[model samples]
Structures are given as structure tokens and as C-alpha cells.
Target: MFSYCADPSVLDGWWWFSCFLTSATHLDFYRAFGAVIALLLVTAPAALAMGMAGAMMLRSQIRPLSMLGRFYVNIVRGVPDIVFFLFVPIALGQGIEYLLHLVNCPDWDQPVRQGNDFLVCRDAKMPPVDAPAWVRNLYAFAMAILAFALVFGAFVANTLHGAMQAVPHAQIETAESYGMTRKQAFRRIVLPQMWLVALPGLSNIWQILIKATPLLFLLGIQDVVYWARELGAQKTSLYSYPHPDWRMWYFSILLVFYLLLTWASERGFSWLTRRLSHGQATAEGERLRRATA
Candidate 1:
């Protein structure tokens, strides 16, 4: 910003643009990008953990356990992500409040549902009625993260399950020859090998996770997209830095932010793939050997 920024009317040329871009709302806009990154950082691992559990369940010998896991993976895949994003939080929130009501006010006989409305005691409210603003925001963010994890976890489970199956039969047979049980063979041979096959799919899922971060705005998170829209909308002439229809430009910045994120992720994955492929039995390992030779 130029010294002349103190006198708004005196600003001209690039000074006007610079001051506008550095405004408080724009600072918030910049921070929103960090928020998106944070969401991905939190959600990706959560989804992976959930997926691993789901996959393990599906692979279990117990019939009910396998059915429960398979049902979760299949049902989630059939539903559109956006629909789950919208529905899950509402359902979870209501379910939580309803459970709380049953525990906190067992003597009260008022019905929770009266036509279109779902009622809960004031004490039953999540974050409570007098929660700090940040608490409410945190609750919403937690819900969004859960929604994203649940949706993406299904895909991750499917990929992981397939990767588990892709492990060579001969490898398992060799392990069996040593008198290894199913669990021992799986742990020593199949589980270790599955990562090589699963990495590419997991990398793709990571990219999808990055792209889905913007949908946090839909769940009322003050994410980057929320700040972009807030700052980019038409500013009234009353504001010190007035702009007309700058939403497109603001969104262009958002686009570049996401582009940089994905690019960084791609580079990181490339390095990881190389690192993971070394000394492996896969094609990448063979190529590395030839290249080194």
C-alpha cells in the first residue's frame, strides 16, 4: 500500500487496487484459503481411518460384521455426495438432541415431532443456547468434517478392499507353506503389498478431498468460499473502497488458490510414489532398477 492510501480520494492508478485488495474482508478472504487447507488436513486422515475400519469389517469372517460393513460402503456409494452432505448433519444433529432430551427430561411427555418441526428442550440444544460464537462455528465445522469423512470413507473402503484382493495368490500361498494362519499371512504378505496398489487410488481420493473442501461453505462453515463470496459481492459506494461486480475476480483468486493446493499435493504424491516404490516387486520398482543400472 502507498502512503497516499491514508487519503482515499487521492488514490489513483495501482494504489487504489492495492488498497482494495488489502482490505480487512480481503484479509479474511486470504485466511479462508488456509481454512480450506485445514479442512483437508483433518478430513483426509479421518476418512482413511474410517475406511480402514470399514474394510476390515467387510473382510471379517463374522457374517453380521461383514454385512454391516458392506452395507455402509454400498449405501454411501449409491447416494450422491451433495445429498449426504446436506442430510447427514441435520440427521445427526436431531438424533443427538433427541437422545439428550430422553436422558435429561425423561418425565416430560412432550412429543419431539409435531408435524414439520423437531423440538428439544433448551437444555438439549447442542453447544447449548448460550454458547460462544466460536463454539457454534466449531460444531458446524465438526459436522461438515464428519459428513465429508463418511462420504469419502466409503470410496476409500472400496479401493482398499480391492487392493487387498489384488495381492498375489502365490504370495499368500507361499506364506501358507510356512504354516502361517490366515491372519498371519494377511498381516505379513497381503496387508503390506496392498499399499503399493492402493496408493494411486488413495492419491486420487486425496485430490477429491481437496476439491470437496469448498463444500464446507454449504454447511455454514466460514471457509474460503464463504469469505470469497462475502468479500467479492458488490460493495456499496459508502465503503472506503467501493467496487462493482468484483465477484468474478475474487473467485478467480480462489481458483488459483485451489490450483496451487492441488499442484503441491501432486508433487508430494509423486515423491511419495517414488519413495514407496523402491525395492518393491511392482513395475515402478523394476523401472527404478533399470534406471539405476
Candidate 2:
């Protein structure tokens, strides 16, 4: 952006570097980092909500609902998450478009799936063919978020279910002995204590989630990985800012980004665990009690 940068031929060393970093695409690359952060922030809560629903289903008195919940956790756990990450978005996207096609073009439709090709009317296409670039980006982002939520939600469900079971049955029993209903006991006694038990597993899952964000590139979102590849590609001398293959450097930066993310998350979770464990019946609480005594 400096006057020296006006003639890129004369620019060298740090001057060239400064001008290159100020390019529009480079600015986009910097902004794309926020997309990854946004995905994590949005996906974590969405996954937690889905997991809570799944946990509730697992605990349902209705046999069918419980079986469905257990099946979701078990069957998904069997498949590799990367497989789901790849397949879920394409399938869900086409499924949504297909449904829309059937709704909007009932009279004119040919079969949507003829052999391998998935065909839908133009109007039914997600964001339509005419939609703005940002709309298309938003659509891809939504699909990625859905995929992340579904996969992590299953893991969260399993963790929460186990945590619920680990909560002392005697606590619930005592509540019942005091004339509390099953729901009342769960609300007043079981739920509060289960969180301390769940915290460690949930913290581990959050780290996994942090690492999994790079997969957004595969889902067609313009996330940090996409930007890294774009910016790090070898550039010819004909280009305003020429560089050799810089992917290694770009990815090293990404590694540092994720390292910082996980480290911060770990420190925060550790503090939370300490806070939660301070006055409870868990080992941490016992250790504190002994130390204080």
C-alpha cells in the first residue's frame, strides 16, 4: 500500500511483502479466519442442543424413543466422522433441493435421480443459479454447520448419557424417599451433579471440535483452509505479487492458530472444572476438603 509498492518491479524484501499482504485477496484471507471461528461458536451450541435432545430421548420412558436415541449414538459411533463429514452435506443438500423441486414443480418434473445424476428444476436449486456469491457461501456454511452438529451431537449424547447414569442413584432415591416425583428428582438432584461428571468428556470433545474445523474446506466453505490454499499457491512472476509454493508456511500458521485455540480452551475448561469440583462429592472435592482440614 506504500508509494514504493506502486512499482512492484522496484519493490524488494520487506517492501514487497508489505504490499502483497495488503492486497484485496489477502484481506479476504484474513477475514476468512473469522469464518472458521464463527463456525465453531455456532456449531458448539447447536451440537449441545442436539445432544441434549438426544440425551433426553435416551432417557425417555417410551421404549421406541429410547431405542432410537441409542441407535443414533451407536450406529454413528461405528462410522468414521470424516466419512460423515464428506457425505452428509452433499446428501442433505440434494435432499433439500429435491424436496423443493417436488413442491414447486410437481407437474413438470422428471425423476430427480436418473442413474447417478441428481437433477432438480432451476428454481429449486439452493440459492438458485442466479443468487449472489455471498448467498451461495452462506448456503455452504449452513450445510457444514449441520454436518458438524450432527456428528458431534452423537458423541455429546453418548457422553451425557453416561454422565447421567454415573450420577449417584442414591441421590435420586433419596429425593423419591422425600416424596419427589421422577421428574422432580431428575430436575432437583440428578441434573446438577451430572455436569461435573460430564465436564471432562465435554472438554475433550471441544478440543476435537476445534481440530475438526479445517474440514470446512472439504464442505465447500471459504474457510481458513480454503484461503490458505488460495494464498499459498505458487504465483508466477507475471503476477503483481509473485511467490513460490508457500503452502507449508501457510499451514504452519494454521497449526499455530489451532494450537492457541486448543490451549485457551483447555485452560478455560480446567478453570471451570476446578470451580465445579470445589464443593462436590467427587475426588477433587475430597482432595480440597482434606487439604483445607
Candidate 3:
């Protein structure tokens, strides 16, 4: 960024170092860190909502809904996560395109599958061929988010399902005796209590989700891992800011980044657990009560 950086080859020591660190590529790398954080912020809540819905479906009194929920949890959890990471985006994207093609290209008579090619009318293209790079990136990012939500949602579903069941039957029966309907009892009583049980599992899932952020690279999102590898590679004499193989250093930074994330996540969850446990009957809750007294 410095004026002296105009000729990086002639520069030395701190001047060269500062220039290299502030290079355009390095700036993009720095921004990728924020991208990772953004993905986590967006995906976590979306996944939770999907999970809660799946869990509720599993617990539905309607037999069909309960069966659908069980099928969802079983099918998703049964498959490897990496497989889902690879499959969901393509599947979801094609599914969306297929629907759009049907709606937009109703008159096109050609088969969508010609040999290995999946064809759709020009109007059926997701962002259109003339769309900007950022639009394409955004579409890919949206797909990645959906994939993450579906996979992690299953884990959340299983966790919440168990947590819902862990709530004492007597409490629900007591609520029922007071003339509260099943839905009312669940909303007012069972739901709040279940968090105490679900939090630990959800915390573990959160950690997994953190680790899984790197997989965004596989989804073509140009995430932190992508930037790290790209920026850390050895540069030739032809390049303005040439450097040796600094990948080890770049990866080390990523390692520290994730460590800090997990550490911060642990602290946050601990505080949440304490808050959720307040005035409850569990050991932690009782301890909190006594401490307050």
C-alpha cells in the first residue's frame, strides 16, 4: 500500500513486508475471514429453524407427519456429511432450475437430459448468463447455505427430538390436568425445559458446524481456506509481490482462527446454559438457585 511498494523487488525488510501484506490478494484473503463468519451467522439460525421444524414433525400426532419426520432424520443422518455437502447444492440447484424450466420453458420440446448434459432454456438460467460475478457468487452462497441447513438440520432434529422426549411426562400431564391443550403445554412448558437438555448437543453441533466452514471451498465459495491456499502459494519472478512457499504460515493462521472461534463458542454456550438452567430442577439449576440465595 505504501508508495515505496511501487517496486516491491527493490524494497526490503519492513517496507516490502508491509506492501506484501497489504497487497490486493492479501486484502481479499482478509475479507474471506469475514465471509466465514458471515456464513456461520447466517447458517446457524437457519439450520436451527429447519431442525426445530423437523423435530416438531417427528413429534406430530399425525401419523404421516411423524413418519415424514422420521424419514428425514434417518435418511440425512444415515448419509455421510461430506456426501450431503457435495450432493445437496447440485440437487437443490437442479431442482430449482427444473421447476423454473417447467414454468418458463413450457413450450421447449427437447429433453432436459441429453446424454450427460442437463439443458434448460435461456430464460431458465438461475441468474441469467449475463449476470455479474457477484450475483453468481451470491447464488452459489445461497445454495451452500441451503446444503448446510439441510445436513445440520438433521443433527439438530435428532437432538431436539430427544430433548423434547426427555421432558418429564408428568409435567405435560400436570399441564393437561389444568386444561391446557397439548400444543399449549408444549409451547409454554415443555419447550423451555427442553432447551436445558438440548443445549449440550446443540453446542457440539455448533462446533462441528464451525469446522465444516472450510467445506465452503468445495462449494466454490472462495472462503477462508481458498484464500489461504491461494495467497500462500509460491509466486514467480513475473509477479509483483513474489514470495516463497508460505502456505504453512497461512494455514497456521487458519488453525488459530478456528481455535479462537471454538473457544469463544464454548464460552458463549456456557453462559447460555447457565441462563437456561436458572430456577430449574436440574443440578446446575439448583446450584444456580443456591448461589443466588
Q: Find the candidate with the highest TM-score and give its number.
A: 3
Candidate 1 C-alpha RMSD relative to the actual structure: 2.0
lDDT of 2 by residue, 138-219 (tens): 8888988999999999999989998999998888899999999999999999888899999999999999999999988887
- lDDT leader: 3
Clashes of 1: 0
1 versus 2: better lDDT goes to: 2
Q: What's model 3's TM-score?
A: 0.97
For model 3, how does the per-residue alpha-carbon lDDT over 1-293 read when each residue is reduced to its tens digit? 66877877787888878988998988899999999999999999999999999999999999999999999999999988999999999988888888899999999999999999999999988878899999999999999999999999999999999999999999999999999998999999899889999999999999999999999999988888898989888998744577789999999999999999999999999999999999889999999899989
Stretches of model 2 off by over 4 angstroms after superposition: 1-4, 289-293
Q: Which one wins by lDDT: 1 or 3? A: 3
Off by over 4 Å in 1: 1-7
Q: What is the lDDT of residue 130 in candidate 1?
A: 99
Return the clash pairs for model 3, or none. none
**lDDT measured at residue 15 in model 3 versus the true structure, 0 to 100:** 81
Error (Å) of candidate 2 at residue 252 is 1.0
Model 1: per-residue lDDT, tens digit, 1-293?
A: 44556766667678888887787777777777777778888999999999999999989999999999999999999988899999999999999999999988888787999898898888899979999998998899898889999999999998999899899999899999999999999999998889889999999999988888888888878888777777778777644576777779878988898899899999999998898899898899999989999
| lDDT score for residue 113 of model 3 | 91
